[model samples]
Target: MFHTLKQVPHSIAFPASNTVESGAAKEDQAISITYDKSVTLVRINCPRQDGHDWVIEAFTALEKCGMAFDMVSIQPGEVSFTVKSRLVDSVYRSLEKLEVYPDSVTDCVKLSVRGRSGQPLLSSMITMAETLAQCNIPLLRLVESYGLIEVLIATGYISEVRKALAKNFNC
Candidate 1:
């Protein structure tokens, strides 16, 4: 499931200044491959009895920690998001203050696959997923915008994932 790309201070994949000219490549072309190597995937499982109020409280606690999160996915019993890997202890402390414990995978990498302008990233997503599958890299999460697809995976497999993507897309 995908939610709005909401970061506290609003950091997005592509800024307004990045524009495509008339002869840019098609959507399948990979413009660039960028990554953040200091991310962690944090998943908090709330008791079904707690309902959705825990979601609000969890966000409040995280905000108090001055955390900027991305790839936020919310479901009935779980809230999954990514934060700086260095902040894992801080996240744990903040949530534990509310008697909530979160499961986290540190040393995660976020890959941003930017495509050509005027093309939906839907197809690129499938290709990227297939590439990852070929490399045996598990995709933790994925989200796409008009010309970008952001994927989360364990940092240990970053090299293999990057190599596979570069081979498949010539990035």
Candidate 2:
């Protein structure tokens, strides 16, 4: 129902290689997208039989609380969603009323990377994962679809993650 919102561009494109031509450049491009500071992740695990119904109820609750979510993913018996951090309390209370307490609620930031033509370049994702690993930053969750990679990382490490990604992408 909220599809009318204007699409905000989140990806920044960078040259794939270090070579710089004197004039026009020709090379593959990589995109870097970072979402930090106002994001919170909410996860709920429900009985498989009732997972679908619970998901609907959870969305209704979020709507009732005037919360806007950025993404939602559902597994066999788990439902995870991301929403603005400011509404965490309202969302938590709303879910509590339905006996749908979250399995884990944590503050996180999202970073994504993709190729120009939506190609799933495994190397990009690996670079990000390796960078976080090397820095001792915890990766809370990761999701990849249609060549887009999204990672939820500890809020405290968002800056460090961004720096690492920037260096890798040479942005």
Candidate 3:
């Protein structure tokens, strides 16, 4: 059926043909399947900056930012996100605010996202960081007492950051 359809529309489609007959009359069950499928994410890549938006609230009623999402994560790393022009209008009709990344939004971004778990594939990148890529997440060690071991982030800190994220965000 995918071959015959010039384009697939939304999560459902009209099946073109079930069968062909020469003369005999037959009953066509006529079945269709509609899937609740929608894109889960939008990705962007930009650089880190100070006072970036993790959440953006329009300053006035006519003010337009047209951003939306469920959760946001920003690190001093790479990644950026954007919305296609066609989607901008309809998507912007909704009211409310947008949570920006903790870091900057302008620069040579690697990837950015704005949606609920839109980037499931990011788990692969996290795993790759554990297995192949150089360690980068910030890390800190708990001081059992005041003025004990000072907190520092370096190559030796990768494992600790991973542990913290795993514990805090269940990542």
Candidate 4:
């Protein structure tokens, strides 16, 4: 049965039959994935009283050693970052010189998921997390920023994680 409105304020047409599918296609085009393999995650323990100082010192040491790092996370008594797997030895040596022992995970990879402009940050994050969870992927560390989510995970799961995200977001 079809019923007509008694009054119409403004004319609005319902979405086309393919609207939902088209929206998913747009999301697939708007999302992009990038990654870096052969990365190492290093975490250094510092005294709470001097954690900040230790962090600065660690940076300086890395600089002196001519090693570059990223994904640096600093907490009250801990600092973690990533460097090229090739530089793990230098990183460990440099830290040892400062009497800082750091635990590290080698054979890691960094994955970045970028969303198009105006995308909802929180929703995108939640969706990404859910996608990973559904795939049984373990996220070692996660960093979220404007329109971007970076995750560190074991290199072995890179393909699986990427496939899951691509499937979930249609990317």
Pitting candidate 2 against candidate 4, the one with the higher lDDT is 4
Choose 3 or 4, whichever is better by TM-score. Answer: 4
Indicate whether candidate 3 or candidate 4 has the larger lDDT. 4
What clash count goes with each model? 0, 0, 22, 0
Per-candidate TM equals 0.77, 0.64, 0.20, 0.73
Quantify all predictions' global Cα lDDT against the true fold: 0.73, 0.67, 0.27, 0.68
**Cα deviation of 31 in candidate 1 (Å)?**
1.3
Q: Give a tens-digit lDDT track for model 2, residues 31-59.
A: 64645555678888883475388788878
Candidate 3, 1-171: lDDT as tens digits: 011111212121112223333443333222121111111223323322533342233223113543433213343443322222243343434322333222211111111111122212212223324422233543221111221111223334334433443443333
* Model 1 C-alpha lDDT per residue in residues 1-171, reported as the tens digit of each score: 223222222122222222334554433442455678888899998844757888999999999988788899998789999988778899999999889999998888887766445444435667778888888889999888776789999989877875675576543
Report the C-alpha lDDT of model 4 over 51-169, residue by residue, as the tens digit: 38778887898899788888888877888888888888889899888888899999887776554453523345566677778988887878787656778899899768756655665
Select the stronger candidate by TM-score from 2 and 3.
2
Which parts of model 2 have CA positions greater than 4 angstroms off?
A: 1-27, 30-33, 47-51, 112-123, 144-149, 166-171
What's the CA RMSD for each of the models? 7.9, 6.8, 21.0, 14.4
Any runs in candidate 3 off by more than 4 Å, and if so which? 1-36, 51-63, 78-171
